[model samples]
Target: MKVLLVTQYFSPENFKSNDIAFELAKRGYDIDVLTGIPNYPEGKYYKGFGLFRKRVEKINGVRVYRSFQFSRGQNKQWRLALNYLSFAFFASIWALFLSLFKHYDCVIVHAPSPIIQALPGILVKKIQRIPLYLWVLDLWPEAMQSGGGIQNKRILTTIENIVKFIYTNSTNILISSEEFRIPILKKGNYNEKIEYFPNWSEDLLFMRQDFDIPALPKGFIIMLAGNLGKSQDLDAVLKAAMEMKNSNNIKWVLIGDGSKKSWIDDAIVKKDLQDNVFTLGRFPFEYMPTFFKSADALLITLSGEYPDLKLVVPARLQSYMAAGRPVLAMIDGAGADLIHKANCGYSVKSGDYISLARIIRDKVFSDLETFEKLGLNGRKYFEKHFQKNKCINHLCKIIDSK
Candidate 1:
């Protein structure tokens, strides 16, 4: 089968979509990826790439096509919007032409806002007419509104219209959580085309691993990995760290970078938490497993408490479980439910730092053996539910059924 994966970001760029595309290629499927320059949370172009030169390269048996697009940065709202828009515009134009000549069975589009990159899939479905499966990592305008990132009423309305248009026209929609299904059904009068496709943990990264937890330090290590952006209410974690400062050995490490790093740094200095807090910014994607193995527990946090926001399923949760480490989630909605179901970690009030700190103190200090058990249970749950083969096979079923 020939598949075209549409995303604004791709390989040599740190993103889950890149790994998924490459894995598909390795499984004997012909895969082509369309993406922009490798500038992510930082917004600046990568070290080696020139501004105007777009390259076509084959990496690990997958064909990747790059094009001109604005990089995201710590800039004004319009600039960020323009960056996404430019990629959407250029990628759609490039994809439309590519589809004219190449024979493709299906086009799977990873999440793209304003329903922009999906335009090419729509074009191909209308022209050569093939199945266009949308892998919705997030529900559009709703995610924007929940994050407090989209305020312009006119623009929000426009985005809402686009969401409805794409969902209505799509052959099938793949969503991560059941919560996502509800909002789309309520807002757009969906035709029951949504399928709940859970995210998977990398087989190589997450699983039962025999690693020495005692070798690292005397204190219990809790980590928060992945992007630290506005949508991540990591401040609560800091507050938890503050509350537990004088207690038993507890250390908090934040891995990855985003718009909120400087703010977190400022908070760390203000709180005088030099001893307990650590930040390892933007490590390579391949190295994530080591950190997961090293930590005694993993932390996941979401910024807001909007009703719509509760439905999000963070990709890092799977990574944490794969490492067989207990997870501490300061998240609401469906994600919290997952933790509760696995009995792998504690799920506290969404943004309540005091309760979070208390939970950590209670879990780690009061009963050390129970803490270890939770971590072991988490790893077991990943083995039962989130293996990579299960993920790819589920996706194949979705494609075949469509």
Candidate 2:
């Protein structure tokens, strides 16, 4: 089968679509990707990638077509808007051209955010009458509102209308979390179409060999990987570290980068947490498994209270589980529920620094046997649910379904 994968972010930008496209191609599917210039967490084009750089390239035998889109600079809302809309516009034009010449059986839209990413898939579906599957990784207006991105009611309503249109048009809507179903249903008539298709850990994480990296710091490392943004509520982690400064030999290692890195750096300096807190910035996606293996526990944090993070499941959780490490979740809703259900870690209420500190000091630091057991449980849970082959097979079934 020939599949067209549409997304704003792709490989070299640390997105799951990179693995998805490669895996689909490996499974004997002709995969073509439609994406923008590789610029993501850094908010600028990657080296050798710019507005006029190579628009077409091949990676691992899969054909990739790039489009022109504005870069999302640091906290620039206008540029961010252009980054989203411009990709949608150019991607749609590219998809329309592809549909006219390329014979594709299906089009899969990877909607990580800015639901506008699905615009190209919708256009291709309209022109070729092929199946269009939308894999929603994040909810739109709610994520924007929660992250303090879009505040104007009028603009929010307009985005909601666009979301409704895209959801209504797609042949299948694959939600990363079960909780996402109701909100999407409220937006469009997709009751029969909506399927629970959660994200999976990359195959490399499972296959990676343990290697000793000298740069790894000593102490009981409690690592947090991925975007250190405001939505992650990492300030709570810093506060917990402050409280547990002299309690144990635990070290708080933060990996990845985002808009909040500057704030975190300033906080570490002001609070004199140089010894307890360590920032590694962003590392290559391939290095993630090694980092997880070197850590004692993996930390996952989300902002807000119990119901605040109900509809989404952070992709990092799956990666942590695949690495066979105990998870420490300072979150609630679906994320906490997953950890609890897997029996793979402990959870404290969001923003509860005292509880977070206590857990790190008492449960995590003191109990090695229990932590190992939790890590085992997490790996088992990952194999049963978030394994890449299983998820991809399920996706294939959905694509081939009539």
> Candidate 1: which pairs clash?
43-72, 206-322, 207-322, 233-303
- Candidate 1 residues 1-402, lDDT tens each? 888888887866766677678778878889988878887767888877645554687888988888678876674677777887888788878787887878888888887344566776677666768888887877778767765467689988898887787887788888878778877887676646888777777864533345332234447788888988777887788888888897777888888888789899888999999788888777765677777777888899986556666887788888788777778888888889889988888887688888888787766667867877887787788888888778877887777675
Task: List the candidates' TM-scores in order.
Answer: 0.93, 0.96
Q: Best by TM-score, which number?
A: 2
- Each candidate's lDDT (Cα)? 0.78, 0.86
lDDT of 2 by residue, 86-134 (tens): 9999888998899899988999999987889999889998898889999
**What is the Cα-based TM-score of model 2?**
0.96
Task: Please report the TM-score between candidate 1 and the true structure.
Answer: 0.93
Residue-level error in angstroms, candidate 2, position 74: 1.7
Displacement of the residue 224 alpha carbon in candidate 1, Å: 1.2
